[model samples]
Target: MIRDGERVTLGDTAVTAHATPGHTMGSMSWSWRACQAMTCKAIVFAASLNPVSSDGYRYTAAASRPIVAGFRHSYRVMQSLPCDLLITAHADQDGATDRFRTAPGACRALAASSRTKLAARLRADGPAR
Candidate 1:
């Protein structure tokens, strides 16, 4: 598994992992600099922010508290980055394909929005019961 904030090299590309544990523990997001000839851009592969389930699922369990906190932290980290491209597991989550062509700050905006939504959900649910 890739450790959070660890940078790994793939051929000429350097990718940094960011642990984002809300949807699942050990979930990761990645950031890298993509270069093409003289043009270069910072890109981020955002992790899934939506919750999912397989069989039995519980978000209010005591075991999930820390995982939820990790997601919040990861959202903050993502908001702080100035990436030119943002790709998430779902295109609609950040409108990666739709907005990538029109906006440079879409990733940051999406991060902030996701964080806000996550905060509200946590507040309303009050953690695992």
Candidate 2:
């Protein structure tokens, strides 16, 4: 959940979380202030980051519900964020930096469109059903 008024102190930078649930009960994504602009940066999923898991492993599908949901909500937030760059915890699925080397407006539009496709697949495939 987006901790209202709670400033995230990370070393020299302080970031803020914007609530973006749907992946789980408390999925939160972060935004940082950068060079006179407020930008959406790294998004840490609560479920994936959580220490406890049913199978006693690290990040798994069940633990990633919030991560998935974070993406859905992030897609919406990205539209409004003045994001010039996009970062992920890892780059296994969403391509490389070459994918987002466009204007902020274009990037936002592209992300939103991609999310629509993912949503459609999720509904049709039932998350591996």
Each model's TM-score? 0.76, 0.48
What TM-score does model 1 achieve against the real structure? 0.76
Give residue 100's lDDT in candidate 2 (0 to 100): 31
lDDT of 2 by residue, 1-129 (tens): 337336788776777665644434465545564443664344322211112224433232476566556666656665665555544333432444543333455436545655665566456434431
Candidate 1 at residue 27, lDDT? 82
Give the top-scoring candidate (TM-score). 1
The lDDT leader among the candidates is 1
Provide the lDDT at 41 for model 2. 48
Runs off by more than 4 Å, candidate 2? 1-5, 35-73, 97-103, 106-110, 126-129
Compute the lDDT of residue 76 as modeled in candidate 1.
83
**Candidate 1 residue-wise lDDT, 77-112, digit = tens:** 777776888777775664355424226775667667
Error of 2 at 88 (Å): 1.8
Q: Scored by CA lDDT, what does every candidate get?
A: 0.72, 0.48
Q: What lDDT, from 0 to 1, does candidate 2 have?
A: 0.48
